[model samples]
Target chain A: MTEEQTRENGDAPRGKEKSEQILDAVKERRNRQRESAAAEEKTVNLVVFILDGDFYGFYGEEIKEILPYEPVTFVPGCPDDLLGIINVRGDIESVVNLHRMMGISPGEPTRDTRIVIASAEGIRSGILVDGVEDVLDVPQSEIKRPLATLDRSIREFAVGGETLYNEKYVTILDVGKIFSKIVH
Target chain B: MQTQTLFLLLFTLKGIRFGVDMEGICGMEPLSRTSEREIPIGWFHEVLSLEISRSDYQSPMVLYLQNAKSHFGVIIESPEEVNRQIDLENIRPLPKLMEQLCRISPVWGAALTSGKGEKGIVLLTDLFRWRDLSLKIESKTATVAPPAVS
Candidate 1:
């Protein structure tokens, strides 16, 4: 059949359509890149961890390292929040139980317990979490500011919130504000 | 020497002696049983339920302490007592000692050598530094629940 006749009849051969599909694919890829770049600008990297089945994360840059849970020496007269001192590479680092800090029931640590080493205002400390989850690229648009009526203590520690694809909630902690009142 | 006077309210926890400033402490009372939900973070040991008579309504006030800014219930073994005041001016700063103690406990300002030649005074607010540490330990370490006391 002649090209014009086929075009007018709308019965173009399959080979002619291949080029159009390729063009559409390139356009989709460019749109995806633009979307990703915009997302990257708004969100910060967060290392997410689990505590009592709830998801929580901290700014990835704020975390120094993640270590295995080690035995700590309990000190008398220490605050109930103070888990004890752990010897991390010969330096004693105070460890806080994230579950206890969140007012959750204390659960025995298994192999999953991980110590997240973080520094706030030059005060180096370790936080014990139930387990270390994958690091997420949380976008700023997903974060929701905490409501004013939230508990005073809880509000002080929270920086913002992030929503997961499955519609689950994750709290982004403000490590600096948590330790701002503490004297180093 | 001109001395800065600091009034301390002394208390005990797990048989260890520590003191907080009188100004930091609102009040103290005998430790009582508290509901599990009412206790705040970092204060697992100090949670207590107490009754108060204010105006025509009698309600319960949950007395909490700040450990590194984390609120925990205060379980007072004995009624809080106002211990003697120390002169801050007379006290010498123990930078080395304070740094060492900070690793283990929350000690901020210290008062060295009272006029009568006693141990130096250590500020109690520094104890809050370990609030996260203590809670972390409690969660990981297996603990036997204390027997119910009548």
Candidate 2:
């Protein structure tokens, strides 16, 4: 029987079968392209730091440099988060206590404390951290949103969270939002 | 004040320990030394006002070692001592228990946790930020007069 006559007799049609095979091939190619794009987008580097005995990280690209802690000049009538101004490389930067920013008690600076220099919205500021951990390669799929119970300020500052191989939670900071308010 | 480690005079209130940075605190004087009549209106009613001598010859301010909002003043029954040169490494974050107590007042001192945990240092400066923000909001609301009735 001819192909049209076979379809009328309730048999598999030749033309319909060929079109289905072509459609399947297009879908398979599209899926392969999408998978590779997703994989490429997930790769990024981050520098992690400890604050309030908890681990937090920010994208490495956002950080300018990490420096040793120096005495901060106290300015009267400044905001509580502002620990005063510090002279870093002849440029004055506002030093902020991350503990205070996190709405936690401020810890006195120890030998472990490090000042992390970062630029947000073109305005450079320094954040005092309890200690510097290490730089890590964190993939995008590993990051998730913060729990609802986390502090509201933390939620605002963090873009997402990641769980390390050891299963500890690491929060990824959003530098743009952090600096946007300060720059204005 | 130039020292790396800050000293704080630790005290107890409502069964919780609270601390203030030694720099922010002038000297802690006897409660009997200051007269209650000189105390401010919003000062903690339960605390016996103590004279706090500060820089810049202004009037000596009264110190109240109690939660001002709740008016629960804690009496320093025993002699209070100062904790000196507490290293930052030694001070740990506030435990879940102490954090709850801190919300009641901004004047909490140092909290001692059990099981070899480090003492939690409380900063009156940090604690007052929340109160200051609330007061600003309140003042703004009060200053803006409501629409007058027709």
TM-score of 2: 0.45
Docking model 2 quality class? incorrect
Q: Identify the candidate with maximal DockQ.
A: 1
**Pairs clashing in candidate 2?**
B18-B108, B18-B109, B18-B110, B19-B108, B19-B109
- Superposed model 2: Cα runs more than 4 Å off: A1-41, A181-184, B1-150
C-alpha-based local distance difference test score of model 2? 0.55
C-alpha lDDT (0 to 100) for residue B4 of candidate 2: 58
Backbone clash total for model 2 is 5
| lDDT for each residue of candidate 2 in A8-109, tens digit (9 for 90 to 100) | 999876565877899999999999999998886686788888888888888899899999998764433344556655556544566766677677786888
